[model samples]
Target: MEATSSGRRSKQIRAKKRIEQLKAFYIHLAVFIIVNIIVIAGAVSGNMNNGQSFGEAFFNFNTFSTFIFWGIGVLFHGFKVFSYNPFFSKAWEERQIQKYMDADRDEMKKYS
Candidate 1:
């Protein structure tokens, strides 16, 4: 009974942690959108004031550069929050652990 309760508590803790991660990700996304909008707006206004057309002001690299660069960080944060690690998954970690353990065992055999 105690073990079951402990397991349930652990599950609750994990759920809470997941909820917090999701909340943080959402907040990050909101900030990213808000700040990028402001930056793009400012760039557009500044470019237009400098004699550029609306099309040139709104569609230029400088207008979207912040989004392009900071977007990569936001994407990585979202990936982490969502547990979408393509480079190092649980299976990959398990394989790495097994590989190291095998190496240790081989070293022991060499000594024995």
Candidate 2:
């Protein structure tokens, strides 16, 4: 009797994890936008009596401007990955899955 390979299963798990990560990233974006809106709204309702510039008062997504640069970065990365050659992208994922499968096969062979 032979044991079935778990590569496909492992790939599924990896894909699921990636999806969750993507979802979390989008959630962060949503929160950021909403929070910024509230902040800006508060600033708008109040007089500009604070001893700081507008740029200094609000959260900026710009890299040179704030830490939000990373969020902007991976957002574009996700955009480019989705926009350019989706077939190639899927192929890359499949290849990753197969590579995991093959590694498992090799390991099992070594044990047997």
Candidate 3:
């Protein structure tokens, strides 16, 4: 049937979109890790050259700040990729649709 084929196509499209999202998330994670490692390494080396101890250099705020900030972005990206919206879920969408439909019915009743 046409409806069955359309449903299958819709599912395929959604699956493809999900795969793309996952791929993008992985790329983002890789970049985050690689860049943070470079930044932290530079910070540590610079600090040690300035006479700081290894532990002090490695654990400095400046050394880890990039990781912390970029990690926040990666966390948000993960949430988006994983479809982790708590507020605007399917139930919320259905409720909003029903609410609007009820409002429209009430307005039509007043006109009739």
Candidate 4:
């Protein structure tokens, strides 16, 4: 039936979108790890060149600041890709549309 084919197509489209979201999240995670490692290594080397010991350089605030700040961004990206935000969901949009329609109807009734 046409309805059955339409339902199947809808499901396929949703699955494809979910797959793309997952792929993007994975790429984000990989880049976060690689870039943080490079940043930390560079900071450690720079600190040591400035006469600090290896442990002092590795544990300094400057070394982990990039990881901490960029980590917050990564956390938000993970939430956007994997979690549902009820405030912006389709159901919320539908409810807002109905509310506006009801308000418009009441205004028309008042005028008439």
**How far off is residue 39 in model 1, in Å?**
1.2
Against the true structure, what is each candidate's TM-score? 0.91, 0.43, 0.84, 0.76
- Where is the poorest 10-residue window by lDDT in model 2? 58-67
What lDDT is obtained when candidate 2 is compared to the true structure? 0.63
Off by over 4 Å in 4: 86-98
**Candidate structures ordered by TM-score, highest first:** 1, 3, 4, 2
**Cα misplacement distance, residue 40 of candidate 2 (Å):** 0.8
User: Across residues 11-97, which tens digit of lDDT does each residue of candidate 1 receive?
Assistant: 999999999999999999999999999999999999999999999999999999999999999999999998899999999999999
Q: Name the candidate, 1 or 4, with the larger lDDT value.
A: 1
> What residue pairs are clashing in model 4?
none
Off by over 4 Å in 1: none
lDDT of 4 by residue, 49-110 (tens): 99999999999999999899999988888878887665588788899999999999999999
Indicate the residue-level lDDT of 105 in model 2: 100
Residue by residue across 53-89, what tens digits does model 3's lDDT show?
A: 9999998988999999989999989988987878799
Best by TM-score: 1
Candidate 3 global lDDT: 0.94
Task: Write down the TM-score for model 1.
Answer: 0.91
Candidate 3 has which clashing residue pairs, if any?
Answer: none
